[model samples]
Target: MDEERNGTGTHLSDAQLFALAAPAAGEPEALPAHLSLCRDCARALREWKAAVGAVGEADAGELARRSPEEWRAREDETLEAIRKAGSHRHSIPAWRWALAAAASLVVAVLVLTARRTAPPVAAVAAHATPAVAASSDMSAADAADDRLLRDASYLAGGGDVDSGSGLESRL
Candidate 1:
């Protein structure tokens, strides 16, 4: 009986007692001998087995008595609970789609405006060439070109003809 201790404690945990109560064939040798000599462990194991059997019987009876309608209702309740607990919403709202479209239109209008206002690649490259000297005629020509480009961009952007620096104001 002393040999059954295996140099560890005399008592067993609930899991160890449960394993001993329902063991597979030809498991470790020492547990049965220990249970026989230990009155406390033997009594605990008996109680554990009885409790497990009673729970199993109750579960079997409950399952046997369940009707199809009751099962469906239970399943629906479980599914509803799962839906409520889920993180994702159903779908994006209409306002979000409208905002996105408005944002896209703003971006497109900005890109078109930028393209229209930007100097042509050829004109930029022309300026890269060294000039002989600063000339008043060249400066005047550059100013006229700038004013034309600005007027063209303002008109293309749908500036009101009846208002703002129109032909009447220029005249």
Candidate 2:
């Protein structure tokens, strides 16, 4: 930034120049053109841009100075820091992993044991008779339907059913 005085020396701070540039850079109006027209503001903008680049370079150089082992250590530290920053961000605990692995192993063993020790399904099937019946319309009302009552004598006599009350009563 240039703080000019008529035949007198003056100066401007980097902060002031940066402040002036920040607003114009964000604006969508003629302020940007006005910013360029002021050589001091333009120079100040370049200087700020360069300063940022320099800081980034310094950071990169510092990171590059670490040995591979040190780099790994730094990476691990960063990961751990990030993990610690949020309690939920870290990995599962070793004990939890072990428990899960043990559970899986036990499950596998039980499955294998069950496959071998359990009785064969086909053996059970061969001995079991089907329990479901198809039809169930037999009732006294159906049997005593007046139109069919003419056959009541024969029905009461009974061929398939032994009970003297006859088929419907036996059922």
168 Cα displacement, candidate 1 (Å): 31
Tens-digit lDDT string for candidate 1 (1-171):
232434434767777776766665747335667676777777787887787777777889878678999999999999998887662453446667889999999999999999999998888768744332333336776755555555666778987657554544543
CA RMSD (A), model 1: 11.4
- Model 2 residue 66 lDDT? 70
The alpha-carbon lDDT assigned to residue 162 of candidate 1 equals: 71
The digit string of per-residue lDDT tens for model 2 on 1-171 reads 346622323334566555554445666223345344556665666787677667777889767467899988989999898878766534457668899999999999999999999778987665442311211444657545532443465665654334353445534
Q: Global CA lDDT of candidate 2, please?
A: 0.60
Give candidate 2's TM-score. 0.26
List ranges where model 2 is wrong by over 4 Å: 5-13, 20-34, 59-61, 64-171
The top-ranked prediction according to lDDT is 1
lDDT, model 2, position 161: 34
TM-score of each: 0.29, 0.26
